[model samples]
Target: MSNIESLLPHLGEDDRANFMKAVGSIGAAFAARTTIEADPQVIAALPQVRDHVLSGGGVELDMSAALDALKEEPSISNQLIAAEVKVAEVSKIQSDTANMSRIEKMNYARERGLDRPRDDVASTMTMNEHAAVLAGLSPVQRMNYARRHGLV
Candidate 1:
């Protein structure tokens, strides 16, 4: 028998069942809160723990220790933080681009070398013309434009 299974003999049948159910519930709750990928061993163990609890035969397991064990496992928390940072960066870029005037956007794009000629007439281009040039650039190009102009 496993070390955990050997502990079951200390509890009465009803208490064992309840303990197993509690462990399963705790595992489910932990899975919901974090992005940790599921493991087959963990999947199988939760139900067994519940079964052992239901069997009403095991010693009282330390609930805090069980929870701590889950907490100690490496999770996707870092990946989540990185993803959030990327989203915030994209959001900031979009906000900066939206705030720029058409002329400023065009000049910013030109500074990024987006193939538009740096003609003397560029400074005199109409708002519509500026918008047209800005529209021709990709979203990434627009972000670069904003970054070059210190708008980001």
Candidate 2:
């Protein structure tokens, strides 16, 4: 409400259609960013996207400036501002996890067969860290690993 009031002065009186397009653009941009960032594999590749959005510029979903470029009525402008807030809220929801205790989190994971044993050393590796560990092993060590894991 207040955001719309603040930005209304920048819009032209006849820009209702452009305001709608800007709002839609802002929403589509946000949804696209969210989709890209959701994938752990792609996340590492998009440093520009990660640095810009994940680090800071995400909430800068700039519909304010978008609307400011267009001309719109006060009523439509208000609705557009409200839509921008809705876009920002999706990112907020992603950052927040349900307030669960560690035990509860473990239980939740266990229920879904996703919990790792607390003492499992390999569970903590990043990406191909295990491959590096395996590469470092001696022939004797490799044979032992295969025997211990019942792979031989």
Candidate 3:
């Protein structure tokens, strides 16, 4: 069994599902946000520094001022920052997924003769069908129909 699957036995069902969702969300976010950079330690790492800037989110900082901050705190770790950013992104994704999953589960339960709402509009009519209905009417009738529906 996978690590997450093994952990499921230890958790309540709701918590297990939540944790799985959180993990999946985090993995997805990390995958999305990752960017590769050249390793600094390797020789022939041209230009002597990784002065690469992130592409436009419209950050407005003077390079000199930014450099001074870096000089003061040279131990800054992108991995930590990225991890925190990813956690927030992942949480949002998990919440959205959970909500959608709940809806889908409810829909499935309904399909299985469970708590389904009545009065569902099951019409599969296309736009062409709707247009045909309009076309079938006399011009005056169509105009009146459109006027009544505020479509005119």
Candidate 4:
């Protein structure tokens, strides 16, 4: 079982269900708040519980202290937000590239110097031809293309 699964048995039924729902919304970085040493399952689950509290996961517990605790760690929250932004940017780039037309793909390759002898013919190239051209680019060239399109 995952660490989170193992820790679930320690919570009350309602608390456990709420915690599971809250975990889906919590950022991955919350796990960093935990210590390396083994502890009681309930103690091990505190970071997630704290996240649930901060998120107002329909629990009756007062959140003032949890809010205050989060206020004290602004940097961690900022880092999490920044990481989320990067993930979003990458996802957008992937979706955009995956749906790009042949002309669009060739234009991207040409802009990154991955295409040779750029000409009007590129604009009329078939999808198979575009794929072959893009596939033939060097690793560095491919990386450059991705970076230019904000995939990296």
Top TM-score model: 1
**Model 2 TM-score on a 0 to 1 scale:** 0.21
Off by over 4 Å in 1: 1-16, 35-40, 43-64, 74-152
Task: List TM-score per model, in order.
Answer: 0.31, 0.21, 0.20, 0.28
- For 15-71, candidate 1 gives per-residue lDDT tens digits of 656755665666665566654443434532443454446455364545455554555
On lDDT, the leading prediction is 1
Residue lDDT tens for model 3, 25-81: 333333344432212221111111111112121233233443333333323345446
lDDT of 3: 0.43
Q: How do the residues 1-152 of candidate 4 rate in per-residue lDDT, one tens digit apiece? A: 24555555765676676765454323222344421122233333445455554344654433344333443465645655667786897776677679799999888767766555334333555556656766989999877754544334
Q: What's the distance in Å from true for residue 65, model 1?
A: 3.7
Which consecutive 10 residues in model 4 have the weakest lDDT in total?
34-43
Looking at model 2, the pairs that clash are 12-71, 15-71
Q: What count of clashes does model 1 give?
A: 13
Where does model 3 exceed 4 Å of error? 1-6, 35-152
lDDT of 1: 0.57
Model 4: runs farther than 4 Å from truth? 1-29, 32-72, 101-103, 109-152
**RMSD of each candidate relative to the true structure:** 14.0, 16.7, 22.9, 13.5
Clashing pairs in 4: none
C-alpha positional error of residue 18 in candidate 1 after TM-score superposition, expressed in Å: 3.1
Candidate 2 lDDT at 117 equals 36
Worst 10 residues of 3 by lDDT: 43-52
- lDDT value for candidate 4? 0.52
